[model samples]
Target: MELIQNTPELSAYLAASDVIDHEHPLVRTVAATLRADASDAYTYAKAAFEFVRDTIPHSHDIGDPRVTWRASDVLEQGTGICYAKAHALVALLRAEGIPAGLCYQKFDVVHGLIAVRLPGEERWARQDPRGNKVDVDAQFRIDREQLAFLIRPEFNEVDWPVLFAEPHPAVLQCLQEAVDEPHLWQTLPTEL
Candidate 1:
């Protein structure tokens, strides 16, 4: 019997890493739900994305001292900053065989989903689950992405890729077992 080789693309997106433990029971449950409910990859991606965005609260947003760095922990704790929430989203999407990675803005990043709105395209959208806002509703699509925070000029923000497989050690360290807001902020990595 010969070993079957996974395509590079499949391997990169689907394989579990330290932070993204897709094999965990919770992750598998989300994957199963996406598979059962969604008819296509795009639909599945949207469902998974919404699940995390709406369900999980940002740690700081909730004033929750505990910070989550792992996808499993994010699900278990139901609170995480943008990075932790993104980790959970990436893991969920990857578990469903959808290609997902981390994308960031300056002070506030786009979390896991990345898209460029094209001229007159209505479907590309994004959202920030960070808070509930009358003006900001959920946005899910590849065409007109609607994220939570508008990139402000005063922020001096930069767009970049932050994590792919695992939470960066520096980030993990910043959030690791933090018990309060002051400690969390004091330890948070600034290089993002």
Candidate 2:
């Protein structure tokens, strides 16, 4: 499989050592596995996303900040906040040929999720652990009553804010800026 060039957000992420050396064996292992399995980028990306979503338990409470985490951290502890989990997925997807990025939403609290908006696709997909294949796209976001049609009971219980059809304006701006400044991850605020 050919390695697709990193999206601006992904490129910035890889330039940061803290993210690349995120303290978790699973993160490194997953990244390595994706790199090795170059045949099918989409399959590798989806599998990696599923691994993080299903294997790591979600924590409602915000924990200590002193604990710097990577994908490996969540994999080892079997739990993680949404941001870390999304970060891990991003690392793995980028290691492969897939183009992936992070999408931050204001959910009472700021939360981030992994997003893979494949080129030429109108909708973005989200990974649901309890769902059929564990990889679901936003195009499946149905009306309130229609939720049952798209998600399983286990996934329905979690509060998933509606995904925006278009990327947030601020996020788009940041991504544009990143194209010029590849190392912008270090200077930008973590909110987005």
What is each predicted model's overall lDDT from 0 to 1?
Answer: 0.63, 0.45
- For residues 75-136, could you state the per-residue lDDT of candidate 1 as single tens digits? 88898887788788878877766555455566642333332222343322333334345655
Model 2: per-residue Cα lDDT over 117-174, one tens digit each: 4445444454432222234322222121111124234533233444432333444344
Largest TM-score belongs to which candidate?
A: 1
Q: How does each model score on TM-score? A: 0.76, 0.49
Q: Which stretches of candidate 2 lie over 4 Å from their true place?
A: 1-10, 13-16, 20-26, 32-39, 61-68, 117-192
> Which pairs of residues clash in candidate 1, taking residues 3 or more apart in a chain or in different chains?
105-109, 123-144, 124-143, 124-144, 124-145, 125-144, 125-145, 125-146, 126-145, 126-146
Worst 10 residues of 1 by lDDT: 1-10
